[model samples]
Target: MHQERLTKLRNASPAVLPSLLQCDFGDLRSEVERLQAAGIRALHLDVMDGHFVPNLTYGMPIVAGLRKLTDLPLDVHLMISDPAAYVDDFAAAGADMLTFHIEAVPEPAQLIQQIHSHGIVAGVALNPQTPMEALSGCLDQVDAVLVMSVNAGFGGQAFDPEAVQRLQQLRQSHPELLLEVDGGIKPETIGPCHQAGCDLFVVGSAIFGQDDYAAAVRQLRDAL
Candidate 1:
């Protein structure tokens, strides 16, 4: 069921995935409901373990709780080291699609296979500084590729213009695969990312930081 929905989202160019990182946890359920009502197809959950990205974000318990809150797909991004150890846990916790950093995992194919074995979609992420070659020989093994437009540790950072070129390169090579761009995705920057062939745009402050969340989402959706 989730895979079919994901396929539709992948084909629907410029799908906006609001990052829950900027939302107020005190009102998380409402925030998620609001985004869904505003036409968001998926939620991008960033799981950071201070060791990998110098930031400690939410864990699997939060994911388990969120799973019961909304029916939207939980696209969990593991920006932590030793992702292999936690793939089973995140999958059990209700992550519909689990994306781990290529830099963190010694063998990405093994991790992708592990995620698939758990009955969920798998994706690989490349940090802004990480070269495209890192994803070579492995694109066919994963469901998607997350192109980080800014450093992964923190939120509210500026988008790196170089990501545009990377997106173009990946799109050219894997034309049918899902290509997502995260970090610093706003109304102004989304157009450039979309032009670079990014179909999934993971937005943070641009949506949650606004008083009119639905309107903010509409602005991004219309931008594409």
Candidate 2:
């Protein structure tokens, strides 16, 4: 891991990453390259297991394939039942940072340690309805906090207003934490999140759904 790049990413005015869920997976490499050219430093890969979340999405195989294509850091968000069972595999698959749902794991500290043991950054995620209490005693245990602005398991859903309060709480309490807001993040919602102190923004369809990737990314950056 390059500490400088990680530091730059964390300290960036606001890091905007376009989620690959809305991309054309048939030509994933080209799409990722396009995103890179558009000034994206990291890629957000949402890993969903049919049981934890309603939908099933990408896994280690696709992550590994993506690793072979881009040099950008891979931020793999694991929305699965037993994340502990597969952290090492995802790390081996070239994940630069691994985030698992607090709703899925009981002892977040142990899982955080497990993820760090693989020499990758560890993050904890909270769904829209899940309380911050679920993150008790573990706020200091992870590298980032992924605040799901919409229900998990799907992309392009509308932003939930309750997430703004959640972001406020996390920001006020952990000012140094790498705060990230995902789901339904667009030019309209990014401002609220940025004002709430979120530095890492994940834009899905708002960027990938467009004809010009660079222009879309510029709009997101300009909003911040």
Worst 10 residues of 2 by lDDT: 1-10
lDDT over C-alpha atoms for residue 66 of model 2: 93
Give Cα distance to truth, residue 135, candidate 1, Å. Answer: 0.9
Candidate 2: residue 89 Cα off by (Å): 0.7
lDDT of 1 by residue, 70-179 (tens): 87778899999988899889988998888999888746878888888887878889898887898896898888899999998976688899999998998999987789
Displacement of residue 87 (Cα, Å) in model 2 is 0.7
lDDT of 2: 0.86
43-123 per-residue lDDT for model 2 (tens digits)? 899999999999999799999999999878788989999999999899899988889998888678888888888778888
TM-score against native, each model: 0.95, 0.95
Regions more than 4 Å wrong, model 2: 1-8
TM-score of model 1 relative to the true fold? Answer: 0.95
Q: For model 2, what is the alpha-carbon lDDT of residue 128?
A: 90
TM-score of 2: 0.95
Clashes counted in candidate 1 amount to 0
